[model samples]
Target chain A: MKFVLALVALVALAFVPSFAGPYPLGLGIGVLGYGVLATAWAMFSGPTRYISLATVAFFGLGAYTVAVLSETLPYPVVLFVAAVIGLVVALIVGLATLRLAGIYFVIFTFGLTELVRQLVTYYEVNVTRTLGRYVFLPLGPEHIYWQLLALLAATLGMAYWVRQSRIGLALRVIGDDPVVASHLGIRITRTKLTLFSISCVIMTLAGAIQAPRWTYIEPSIVFNPTTSFLVVIMALLGGPNRLFGPLLGAVPLFLLFEWLSANFPNHYSIILGLLFIAIVFVLPNGVLAAGESLWTRLSRREART
Target chain B: MTTISRRTVLQGMGVSALATALSGLPVLAQDRTAIRIGYAISKTGPNAAGAGISTTPNYLLWVDDVNKAGGITLSKLGVTLPIEVTEYDDRSTAEETVRAIERLATQDNVDLILPTWGTGANLASGPTFDRFGYPQLAGTAVTDMAPDLVKRWKHSFWMLGGGHDYAEALVALLVKQRDAGTINNKVAIASVADGFGIDLSKAATPAFTEAGFELVYDKTYPLGTSDFAPVISEVAGLGVDTFVAFSYPPDTFALTQQSVVANFSPKVFYLGVGTAFPIYPGIAGPNHNGVMGIGGIDPDSEALAAYFERHTALNGQAPDNWASAVTYASLEILAQAIERVGDIDREAISAEISSGEFDTIIGKVKLVDNQLRSLWTVGQWQDGKFVGLAHTERAGAREPVVPKPAWVPAA
Candidate 1:
């Protein structure tokens, strides 16, 4: 029944391009792009409680791939290559850094992102001799929206499948206590690596899909560390434990940012920073957990009456 | 239990409704009497410094002046329309820049749109402006790709010439100095490892080599490097008579300060980007004199003096001596083109801009191939003012001071 409902929702979302004009479609593209990223992020970080900040590393790699190959190859082929490159890089990075836990993992991932950005910058300066590249693909905003919608659906489906599967059980165990999971014969490294690779591939695809929206890209623009931070914040704020937490968190937060930025161009950053502080203090467990608690109190009062 | 929460649904609905109302308001307003001009600029992030100094101030001054003069004339409509401005801060990101531009076009239904801050944002937004049929007179964007980009986006015009233009002009000036026996041919070059610096250095290296100047030391430091002591000491030790740094503002300030401390005074010292800024004299004091850089302005132009006075009065800061006047000039061209067309028809405005020449603060302006051919590529500090030293067309250029005076700290 739930699967059917989600399928219905996905199909409904796919029709948004038909009614919406370019403005709304552009906002939708932003929402869907972050939706996939936050969802994919939760799929790995929520289960293991390892905060990975390398999202932009894979995302930028994907964008750069599409930029370098979009002129030479078909759109679909370039997207596939972007995903493949993302997966390979994720596997290597995951193997190297997944052994560390807690803040160590977070710091390492952040370092990895900066490292990759520097490498790309170096290559562009010393090799290509141009710091910025122009991407002239035949993709419109509608095309981007549809593709991101599809990617978001796939990400949600995969998150759900991982939650129900044996790997999900093992991940939960590992999150609870890693030593017990290892004693339970869970291949901790392998399970973590596989999930991380899958999540990173989705991030890469999201980047590749959205690259054409920014017709010109450079290392600093695409590999911005702000992207990784936003994904983390959205997932955590939505209650990463829930399957739809990131989406619930992403939609409203993305809209809020769009609104704040539009309404208060000069002071939006200050307002946004205050809002993030409020979210951390007021809804530490995320909006989903807060809602669940509110529902529990209401129902209990109803039963007493 | 369903994963969709009641609160999420309520918030989403509220946002959707608000978005609908916002987009629908412009259509419902029956009186569309004003010419709505929109732009997305970097008001808050890393790019804000440049936008604040060079781009945004000119825009604010131009709009205020135009409105004070009873707005733009539309001869075809037999009426002059007051301008209504809609601006968004792009937060110095390309994604936000593109989205804001799209919103200006489709949502606010703005008649004219100005270009955004830097090379990347302006280039990123080309296809969007083309799609929406708005003319983009990019003021601050300088790239070797301008000729091709102009062809690609017909409505777009580049004010600042390519990196090669600046490099060629500076090299020609240096060759002239060398011929006068004022300086030797040894040059030390350092550039910031980014688009602006890389482009300038790449152009300058070849130009210098072609002019038979030997490169003594050439290297690039990362973007955010604060410590220039090592780089400055290394270059200072090389005993090069000519030292050129294609650096950004932060690096430029830092390099100048450290060079003063290290006493690395080359006879011919040139820094990029910020050297021609109004603030350079204030920051560098006596050291600013005879220091040449990327852009020059004709200090003798009476129109330019008035522009500077008005800009300083309104913005509480003098505009950068380089791109600020050109930016204001681009607006002059836009206004003239609009008056010529006598309507808000973007196609007509773009055509008029492409074909017509106009008098501006920068003097008789014309774009040969959708680019402003009249540009100052080199300027130097003389008698406490950053003034134009060379032009692309070899006209209206002042004679450069040779063998810059020894560094002296301000009392």
Candidate 2:
């Protein structure tokens, strides 16, 4: 039943570009990108209970990779290279921080993003001797929109698969008790690292696909820490435990951002912050969980009547 | 079997939410008779301070002033059409800036569009503006690639002096001072790492070296840096007699304040962007005396005095001497072009701007090969005002106070 519904949604989204105007198509690209980031982050972090904050590091790496290599290689080839780079970097960071848990892991990942940003900035100044590179892709809004939608669909399908597989059971055990899972013949570090690397590839590919839309890339703009935090907030706000929660959270949140920014540009950030706080307080488990509880309660009342 | 699954419920909610959001978007009304000018300006974010001081008010003032005189008379249509402006705050990011401009062009279908606040924003949106056939008379941009950009995008126009020209004029002034024994031949340079600073620094580095001045120190710092004490100390430690900082507004103020705190004053102190702003003098107090920066205006012109009074009256603040006057002059050019062409067609207006010269508050202005040729390139603060210093061949050119006085501590 769930697979049928997911197929219907994907088919419906695929046709959006045929009828939508430039403004809606542009918004569609951004919203789909955000959806991919949030869902992919939830894929690894939700089951393993490892709150990784390295989305920006991978995103920036992918963007810079395309910026540097897109002139010589085709964009599809650049995306492949970006995924390989993301996988390699993720493995190295995951191995080094495997022992650290909880707050230490969070801090290290946060610091890693800042470290990568500064290093890229230094390299651009000292080695490249240029402020930024201009991208001249000939793709229009409709083409970019379809590409992002395809990426988002792939991310959703992968998330659903990971949630229902044998590795998913192993991850849940590790999240419950790492030492006990290790004793029960589960390769704890290997399982966690594989999931982390897969998530990184998805995120990096999203970044690579979206990079050309910017038309120009600067290190500061590409490697912004704000992107990392926004993805985390979107995933958690939508309900990380479920396959579709991040998607649910991302669509509405990004739409709200677009509306607020267009109407009240000055106070949108403050309003967004307050709204996050409200969500955290009222729906701690997420909006999906809140809706589930509401539906169950109403059904019980209907049965009694 | 009849129960609604969680995934189905979630998909239903997602589709409905998107529908609601899209439906809520305000439809832009299309009035064919009105002269609609659209723009994306930085009302909030890193570039907002500069936009607030220079770009946004000129836009508002121009729109209001035009509408008050019963709009522009279109002899082709035999009717006078009132001007309407639709503005969006870009939040100072390149992505948002481009998105806003695209919305203005495609969604609003504005007949004409105005340029944004800075070099990067203008350059980022240049292709889009060209594709949409809007005449982009960029008011605040300074780039050495102006010729190339104008060539590539035929409808685009740059109104400010190019980076190379500004650099040559500054170097010429310093070389004259060097020959006169007004100061030592040693010079230090630092700039922000953004496009504006990078272009100027790239132009100045070789120009300073070619003029027989010793390049004592050179560095570039990232934008939004609040601490310049260490960099200032390093330059001061090098014992250079002259210092030039190609900076944005925030860093401009920060670098000067830190220099005063570090007591690292040079014989020739020149900063960029914030130097012509009234707030700079207000913050630096008496220390602003003997300081030099880019984009000087004629301080004694009666027309400028009147424009300043009107700006203060309309916006409750004085405009920056550098970019604000050029911005207003660009609007004046646009207004005259529209009136002369007797139509609101983008191609006709662009051709009028390209071929015709017009009188403006900044004196007679002309776009030679899609670039302005008449404007001051440098300014100096003397006796509580920023006076014209370099590029004196233009109108409002004044002799500079050579060998700047030593910096004074605030009382």
Best by DockQ: 1
Q: Comparing to the true complex, what docking class would candidate 1 get?
A: medium
In model 2 chain A, where is the ten-residue run with the lowest total lDDT? A125-134
Considering only chain B, report the TM-score of model 2: 0.91
Off by over 4 Å in 2: A1-12, B1-29, B392-396
Across B16-101, the per-residue lDDT of candidate 1 in tens digits comes to: 54874475444556365888899999998889999999999988999999999999999998989888999999999999998899
Which stretches in model 1 have alpha-carbon errors above 4 Å? B1-26, B409-411
Q: Report clash pairs, candidate 2.
A: none
Q: Kindly provide the TM-score of model 1 when superposed on the true structure, using C-alpha atoms.
A: 0.96
Q: Choose the strongest candidate by TM-score.
A: 1
Write candidate 2's Cα lDDT for B49-85 as tens digits.
Answer: 8888989999988888889888988889899988987
